[model samples]
Target chain A: MNDSVIHIEGLHKSYETSAGLFPVLKEVSLHITRGEFVAVMGPSGSGKSTFMNILGCLDHPSAGSYRLDGHDVATLDKDALALLRNRTIGFVFQGFNLLPRMSLQDNVALPLIYCGVERAERHQRARELLVKVGLEKYFDSMPNKISGGQQQRVAIARALINRPSLILADEPTGNLDSHTSTEIMALFESLNREGITIVLVTHELDVAQHAQRQVHFLDGRIVNDHATLHTEASL
Target chain B: MKLAMLGEAWRAMGANRMRTFLTMLGMVIGVGAVVLMMSVGQGAQYSIKQTISAMGSNLFVLLSGSSSTGGVRSGSGGSYTLNVADAEAIAELPGVQAIAPIHPGSAQIVYGPNNWNTSIIGTTPGYLDARSWPVASGNTFTDSDVRSATRVALIGKTAAQNLFGDADPVGQTIRIRQSPFVILGLLSTKGQGMDGRDQDDTIIIPLTTAQRQVFGSQFPGSVRMVMVQTTTQEIMPSVEKSMTELLRQRHRIREGLDDDFSLRNLTAVADSAAEATRVMSLLLGAIASVSLLVGGIGIMNIMLVSVTERTREIGIRMAIGARQRDILLQFLLEAIIISVIGCFIGLLLGIGGALLVELLTGTKVIIALSSVIVAFGVAATVGIFFGYYPARKAAQLDPIEALRYQ
Candidate 1:
């Protein structure tokens, strides 16, 4: 049996707004295998973001069973969910979300620090990841000192520091120009070829096209899922 | 895990150097002030008590009035006359070690070309022993002087200093209010009292001479007041009761009439003063403690701002695999560190400030180690107590939403 990284059945998430019980995710069921590069696309309020949150273990399903790495999400308490998130998932944000006060190396080492890695070992792992992201020369540079594209590269390096099973990127290139967006997407594709599973959430078609599988979402449910032809060799 | 979290917290705090320092300043001042104030207050009280106790055991003053707490008071008539015979009568009572009737008056002392102002106290031979007055030179007034109403007098150090100037005052003859009197003795110096009055600015003469020759009053054989000493502190009440009964019988008070002469216990008075001072110091400490609370609130305010400002950083950490407790603990630890450091600085500054006050003012300041401990403990408690809410807020944040924060 191919090991499934995440399995969600009939996931329902409803938010209490002034309009009352507005459903963000309605009867959403999906399964993602380990080592798959999947992209989710949708307009605003399409529940794609909600799905990403659930997949990253940052939130629990409202009324559904979410089993991540074969462990049930509902069984986890607040702290246990946090531990699962820390141990199994890594995240990158659209705005890069690099802490401006921290050096590139520190930013990359942050996840490993949360994972309770020793100082020297955490530093070594962060350095290796930074080198992989072509940020070896900029290890000591602060987030603000680097270009938008380079900051995103640092963020990606941070996401890989814990060697997480799944890498979650939400609007990873939302703030970057087209050229930088292509570069960051290419970095994601290269990371995918190394056998790390990726679940990317974005509204942009060009950014979504870089993944092997693309799922479109509308009104809190998946509308269509299509296979995309892209690999590290093509990039 | 603990060390790593601590390191992360330190790094985060060090990142905002100015904010951390400013936040710590409040705790520093508060703790310092509390420690310093308590020490100084305790010192003042201790010194005062020491001065009182040095006056001797169970020394009391009996004055004629409705109420007189101390020797100095206003708006009262001297109704009871404590005469030499009354003094002798009190001396005969059990537990009464010594009794001296004092006749206080002012006079001018003239020796050679030097003349000086001085208070003249006329009493029996036991007067010196009662008041803890030690003779420095010449002999004190003998019982013969009391009977003969002799013109010989014992001069205090201040009187000797003023009238005789470096010359030996024992053999000198000084004119007291133009009446020539031989200085038979020179008394040793006793420092200033709690009332800031000089204890060594007087001349002692025989009680009979002061009553007959100086004042020229005869009826009832009136005297100023009597100083009484008990054999021991435990027998004071019985001594007081017998003396009161004797005086009352002499005065012929009706069945329920209050005694005309009022008795004052020096030990009780000293104890009361100490209690008052203790209460005053406590009040001062309480007022100063408000600053510590304010400091805690200040820490909370800054922590709130810090949590909000670091929302994205919190998200990033959470995404990286940080437990909610880790994030919470990080912020909480930072707040605690700030408070603890503030307390330490406050303690140092407090002690320094107290010393400075003492140096400048010549006031006794006691630095109690307990105060230092209290300051530090208060600071630490403030940190933990006030830092909880913000830490919880930071911990409960959604990673996805926090990451989306621009």
Candidate 2:
């Protein structure tokens, strides 16, 4: 019951510049159990984007021992890493990167298609996810043709299509108005309460308040980790 | 995966109608020109060959005015050069089928009230067999008529129509240059010659009659040229060689000196014409194919731009679970679709062009099914050659960076 979904030990990353190799993350280590709701908060240059990239399997650390769902990600080849990412991780970007040409339903069905799901079943699953994300009315609406809040809702629906073990949202509500951001955060809280592990990267304190645990970072090192007392753990 | 990718390709091309059409225009014109030119050229070749073959394959014309080499004219003014003796000598050679000594000139013929200017060819009895002339109404002149200089004539269909329109004019009298001659027969229609000359606009007569009455030839043994027919096509070379040797020795021409008379082998002339046409067709086809290559490059250029434009879309698909091969196949399919559509349009346009030329110019055009197959195959190959680079680029794009694209 104590299976670690994501584990990192002594992870470090740096960017080679004209000046030198400026380090982004310095020996960062963390672990999250299955179905845990974890939120990360930091200032602008705290290396949270790089950390989210590694956690989402979009990139690998320069030097680290990192494992996701028990697979060693640092040792995997690019194609293999892509497969691992597709199977175990789902991503929600701040931009709500739904294909501008496709409808909301098609955007949701994209992940299922990559997962090799049958066409009819993929459509059925996408429809169910759209309804769950309160976008049943806009199933056929294109991303560009919809409001910003509706587009983000469709993006969240797309992230759940493959039924991945981990949901990685990089500032999922960063582009939304305050009311829409609160609504999206509540939706993420409800999904977390339903036994889905949520790892979110954010700079907004109000958005991070919905998480059960918040880890603060400064200069690429964890400065504090604490549970909020006002919000009781539901699961 | 293939079907899905093909669907995506169809969708992509459909979304950008004008760009897709412009890209395919080069291929269309290339294939269209190749088909049209080849079809028309082959058609003309076939038509000419058929006309020449109909004129009798056995006939070889001997011209005395100009020698075959260097366009050299041997004698100054010609009158009564060839005679019955030379015709007999050609007839006596091995592989010789028949020989006709000819003296041809234009003259005005008047029959009753109608007057027509037509060619007058004076020949012996052998001219009928050598030229494959069929007597449609009356009898050909006998050897006695030629030897005795009797004034008898055989008129062709055109001459018959002009002089004796809708009348049975056999055994009637026609005056050639104020000399009266009896019409012995009517020659059958021979249609037009290979060089577009009217074969039926002539009157045939005994060589002696033409020499004595029509042309007023004072010289005894002279004619314009001699016509020879070989027994078989295979032995024409031997007959030609012996005839040339005999004529050269008769004319006292030494080695390395061009002969005084040119031997016109109909088969050789036909072959050269065919070869010239074949080479012309090949040159035209090669020039037209450059557009096809250009069209292939256009496909590659457009596909590369498409990959760059859809970088994030590709990244999202990759992140979701699509493999590198999937992205590669998608773009490759798009290129192939464009080429295939272009090929179809080109095929139609090419056939239409050929048919239009045939109708407007009165030229026969043949459309071979193999041209369609070849056009399609060439287009598909072009697709593969041009599609590789763009497809590979799509496959090599980094998903992480692509997903971050704004």
Candidate 3:
């Protein structure tokens, strides 16, 4: 590949708790190409969430190098990093973190507003994305007024509204029912088919089975990383 | 801020209308009080100056000093040395407009069943011009009236009302000291003077009649005082100086001896009153500014609370790629908007309050435009001064930490 969308080498993160420095990630290296769907899995202390946070540019690595879209994460300032994230990466959290007071369409248009898009175009693009996610009927409904599954769909639409090449979802289906989880996984699969890269962190193996590649972590280090033909076959 | 950013602030305020209105109320009270104080002060000064000018713009009085005789000290004005001849001498001086001699005494007037006891001022026809007093009805006494020692009188409004009821006092006969005198005119109303003395509670009669009939051989040709009116206000100082010199020379008082007369300028008295009003205005304004400071503290408290309440919102905005400045601007704009609205409300309240003060106190209230601009500017400054810390706190929030904040 000419340039990988996300490349990590020797990534490390630690927390300064009262007990002492507690290491979360230890020298974890991963490369995710454009148009690829990868799944990250581990036990509770595996630091999968920490690794996801590092990839999303929301947290700084203690001792490592991370390059997102050819820009060194450590070298960029907070504002420049925010701009890079806005242009290149979209994040979907397990909480379906749509602002409660905003309407579904307004929630989807949040990213465009940060990028200084004009009002008319921001609304238009948000409406188009809402339609793509089958949320056109709830365009004006507050996020609190919607179902958990519907809120997650709105999050996904928000994440894709910026036309980002990469999506980072941490336990995206963690709060949804199995039926809704499957529906969301199907949406992810369809998006992956459209030449969009996806990296999701999940604890369930069945949910991980939707990805073309699976990486497992234990004790803050990646123990197994492999491609599975059957995962793609099932899709 | 750009339109969208301002809209966001405006919408945020709109979301909690009651809280926003309450916050603005503090500023309104502060600014409104400041304007009201200043306006009332100015109004009082204006009314006082007007009263002074109406009484007499360029006026002064010369009173006869006391005389000592036979190694015995006499009371002030006990031995009259200044007389009517001295008044005529001063009146002929350059820049002098008119001079009226006064012979003041107490008297009781009786007309029909009504009786009123009042002060009697015996003066010439020039007294009205010298004192800026006009005849409200009938006519004033002429030079011939004074020459003949006529028993004609001009009654004051208060004296007339007390003695004549609803009947016209002019051309009517009233008895003073059991002597019936025909009324020449009713003196124009003078309300109350700055000294709290009722100007309209006394009557005016010719000096000759007062000296011959009222005093009746008490002090012939020796008037109590002379009121001098200058042709122009600018010539008052010169007139005062020239009159003093002429009186001293005419009285033949030695250079070492104290003169037998003193000059008092009404304008000087007015200036002192105006000075007191100026000091009062500043004092009131200072007291009012304290409330503005209290209002600023109110803004700081509310802004700090708002920042805490909106932490999650700040986190979400940060995650959506907003810069720190963008977050700061949004919150700061919200503060400015609140204060600006408060300033407008304060202006209305200030004018309304001034009108109310005027109605209650019967003093005119003038709202200075500069006060509005200054109050508005100070209010905006208060907003920025108090709003900065909260806005900075919001902007400095760490995205992950804020996102995890409940």
Candidate 1 segments exceeding 4 Å error: A204-210, A223-227, A230-235, B1-47, B54-57, B64-85, B88-98, B110-113, B124-155, B164-188, B204-223, B230-239, B250-252, B257-260, B266-280, B343-366
Model 3 over residues A1-235: C-alpha lDDT tens digits? 5459888999889999999999999989999888889999999989998888788888899998999878889999988978866778888988887876678888898888778899899889999999999988988999888889999999999999899878999899999999999999999999999999999999999899899899999999999999855844574
The best candidate by TM-score is: 1
Candidate 2 chain B, poorest ten consecutive residues by summed lDDT: B73-82
Q: For model 1, how does the per-residue alpha-carbon lDDT over B1-406 read when each residue is reduced to its tens digit?
A: 7887888778878988998998999888788879987988888888877777656568878876544558754422254455657777888988888888877888777887888888888888877887677788788889899888999898877778887778898877888777888888898877676677887888899988887776556544667688899988889888888889998887788889877777888877877788888998898899889998998899999999999888988887787677888988999999999999899888889889999999999999999878877888888889999998999999998877777676
Summarize candidate 3's per-residue lDDT along B1-406 as a digit string, tens digits: 2777887788788878998999999999999999999899888888788779767878888888876788786755566777999999988999988889888888988998888899999988888997788999899999999999999999999999999877898899999888889998998888878888898999889999998887674668988888888888888888888888899899998898888887899888988898999899989999999998898888888989999998988887787677888888988999988888998899899989999988998888989888888899999999998988899999999888887778
Pairs of residues at least 3 apart in sequence or in different chains that clash in candidate 1: A86-B321, A94-A171
Regarding DockQ, does 1 or 3 come out ahead? 1
DockQ of 1: 0.57
| Chain A (alone) TM-scores for all candidate structures | 0.94, 0.95, 0.96
Give the clash count for model 1. 2
Model 3 chain A worst lDDT window (10 residues)? A226-235
- What lDDT is reached at residue B277 by model 3? 93
Q: For model 1, what is the error of residue A94's alpha carbon versus the real structure, in angstroms, after optimal superposition?
A: 1.5
Q: Residue B173 in candidate 3 has what lDDT?
A: 95
* Residue pairs in collision within model 2: B80-B222, B81-B222, B82-B223
